[model samples]
Target: MTRRWTDAALTAVAPTTWGTTYLVTAELLPADRPLWSGAIRALPAGLLLLALTRRRPHGVWWGRAALLGALNIGAFFPLLFVAAYRLPGGTAAVLGAAQPLLVAVLTVALLRDRPGRPALLAALAAPAGVALVVLRPGAGLDPLGVAAGLAGTAAMAAGLVLTRRWGRPPGVGTLAATSWQLVAGGLLIVPVAAAVEGAPPAPDGPALLGYAWLGLAGTALAYALWFRGAARLPVTRVSVLGALSPLTAATLGWLVLGQALSPTQLTGFAVAVAAMVFGQLPDRAARGRRADQPARGQRVGRPAPGRQVEQQAHGRHVGQPARRRLVGQPARGRLVGQPVRRRLVGQPARSRRQASAGASAATPSGSAPGGSSAAAASGSVNRCAADGAAA
Candidate 1:
C-alpha cells in the first residue's frame, strides 16, 4: 500500500510541475513564440535523456515512439501554449480539466478498459470544480483558443491510452522509453517551428533559466514519472491525477502572484481535491462482488445423493425429500415406463402357500390360456416365497 501511494505521489509530481508552465510562459518566456517554446522545451530534455540512457528504439518501436511523441509532446505543447496565450489562465485550465474525461473515453475505446462509477463521477466533478475556481462570469471565449485546448486535451488523452496499451519494450526502462518519445516528438516539432516562426528567439538569462527548468524538471522528469505511473497503474487512475495541474497552478498563483481566493474558489478547491482523492480509491464494490462469485464450473445448491436419485427417477421437485421404496421392489435398475409391482410385507408363509394352491387350482392344465398362465406364474412366485420362509 505504501509503495503504491509512493508511486502515485511521484506520478502526481509531473502534473504539479506542469502547472507552473502558464506562469513561466507569462513571466519569463518570449511573446509570440509558441512553436519555438514547444520545440525548445522538448528537444533539449529528450537529447539529455538519450545521452544518459544511451538506448535507441528497435523494430516497430520506432513508429510507436514517433506516434506517441507526436500526440503527447509535438502536438500537445504548441496547442497548449496557444490556448494559454489566447485565453485567461482560468479558462485555459478549465479546458485542460476535461482531460480526465477524455482519457476515460479513450481508455474504453482503445484499451477496452471501463472505469468504475466513482472514477467517472470524479472525472465530471473535477472540471466543474475547476470552472468555479477559474472561470469568471464574463470570461472571453476565443474560438481558436477553445479549439486548441480541446485538441490538446484529446491528443494527450490518446497518448496516455496508447502508452498503457503498448507499454515499454522488453528490457527498456522508463527513462529510455521516455527519452525515445521526447526525441521523436521534439524532432517532429523542430521543422514545424522553423517553418511557421521563421526564426527562433534568442534567450536572455531569465528565459534560459526558465527554459532549463521547463526542459529538465517540467518535461523530462515530469514525463518520465508520468509514463512510469501510466505503465504501473490503471489508465483511469493515472489520468484523473491530472487534476493536480490546475490545482497546482491556482496554488502558485495565490502564493507567488498574490492572487486573492474567494470563498467560492476555496469551495471549488476543496471539491476538486476531494474528487482527486476519491478517484484514487480502489473499486471495493467491484472487488467484493468478484470475490463473492463462485468459480467457473462449480455447481450451486446441489441436491443430496438420495434426493438426486429420486428426482431423476420420479421427476420430483428439487428440495423435496426422497420417497421410501416399496417392499419386494429392486434397489436399482428400474426400467423406464415400467409399472411398479409391490407386495405386502409380514404376510405368513401359510397364507402364501394357500394362495399358491388356490391359484394353481383355478388355472386349467390341459389348454393354457393367458389368464391361466398368469395365475400359474403368480402361484409359482408365492410358492418360492413360502419355501424360503420355511427354510
Candidate 2:
C-alpha cells in the first residue's frame, strides 16, 4: 500500500524473473538460436504491449527508444544468450555478477550520482557473493563467451543508468515505456536474427511453451518491472537486485535438478543474500545533502534582506561605514551617558572594545558615563545617570 513497499515489490520482481531465464533457456528453448531467441523474446512481447496500451513513441522518442532498445535489449540479449550458451551456467552467472560495479561507475558518469560507502561496499560484496554462489573452482570459460558476457553486463549497466537519466515521457505508463524499448530492441534483433538464425522450424509442445514463457514472462513482464524500478529508484539499488538472478538460478538447479548443494555453495548463497539485503537499504542520508550546502559563489552567514536594509538605514543616518558594526558584540544601546557606537554587521570587535574602554576609563566612577558635571551635581543617583545620558 505504501510507496516504499510497492517499489520494493516491483524491484524484487525484475531480477527474480531474470533468474529463471538461464534455466528456461537451457531446459526448454530451441538450441543454437541466440539472435532468433532474442528477437522472438522481445518483439512479440513488445508488439503485444503496444497493441494493448495503444501507444507509440513520438518524435525523438522513436530514436531514443531505439537507442535504449539497442543497449538494454537488442545488443544486450543476443550477447547475453551467447554467454549463457557458451559458458557453464555458473560461470555465466559470475560474469553477470559484475553488473553492479559497472552500474556504480556509469551512475557517476551518466546520472552524476557518486556512489556512497554502502553502494561501493555492496558493489564489491555482490559480485563476490555471486562468485561464491555460482563460480566453481573447476569452472572454465570460453574466450569469446567471456567477452560477450562481460560486454552484455556493461551494456545492461549503462542502459540502467540511462533509463534513470532519461525517464519515460509524460503520460506514458511503465507498460508503454517498456514496450517502446522492447519494440526497438526487437526490431534491431530482427535483421540479425533473419540473417544468422533464420526462421525456426515448427516446434513441438515444449519448445513452443518455452518461447511463450520467455516472451510473456521474461521479456514483457521482467522488463516492465525493471524499467519501472529504474525510472523510480536509484540505479545502483536496482542493479544490486541483479545478484538475485544467479542466486535463483543456483537454487533452482539444486532444487529441481536434484543437484547436491555442498556446504560451500550454501555459504556462498547466504553471503549473496546478505549482500542483496544490504544493497537494498535506502541511502537516506545522501538526500537533501546538497541543499544545506551552499554554492561556490554564495556568501557564508550572509545577512537577511531586512537586516541588510536596517544596516543601510543605520549607514545613511549615522554617517559611518556599515563595517563599523560587529554582529556578535554586546549592544551599544543607551550605555548610561554615552550614545550608541556599536556595529551590528561588520568589522572586528577589538577596535570598538578598545574605544569603549578608553571612554569608560576617562570618566570618574562618581559621575555617569558621559562625564557630565551637571548630572553629578543633581545628586539624584538614578536621574544623574539619565541626565548625563541626555547631556
**Highest TM-score among the candidates is held by which one?**
1
**Please, what is the whole-model Cα lDDT of each candidate in the order they appear?**
0.82, 0.78
TM-score for each of the candidates: 0.75, 0.74
Model 2 RMSD in Å is 10.1
lDDT tens digits by residue: candidate 1, 38-140 = 9999999999999999999999999999999999999999999999999989999998999999988888899887888778888998888888888777899
| True lDDT of residue 167, candidate 1 | 98
Kindly report which residue stretches of model 1 are placed more than 4 angstroms away from their true locations once superposed.
293-391
lDDT of 2 by residue, 1-391 (tens): 2785578678878788888888889998888988888888899999999999999889988888988999999999999999999999999998888998999998888777797766778888888888877877777779999999999999899888888888988999999989989999999988988888868546678878888988998889999998888887778877888988888898898888887788888888778877777776766576567667765675677643344433332233222333332333322344443433323344333355676566557766555455444543343223211111111
| TM-score of model 2 vs. true structure | 0.74
TM-score of 1: 0.75
User: Per-residue lDDT for 41 in model 2?
Assistant: 88
Say which candidate scores most in lDDT: 1
Q: In candidate 1, how many Å is residue 325 off?
A: 35
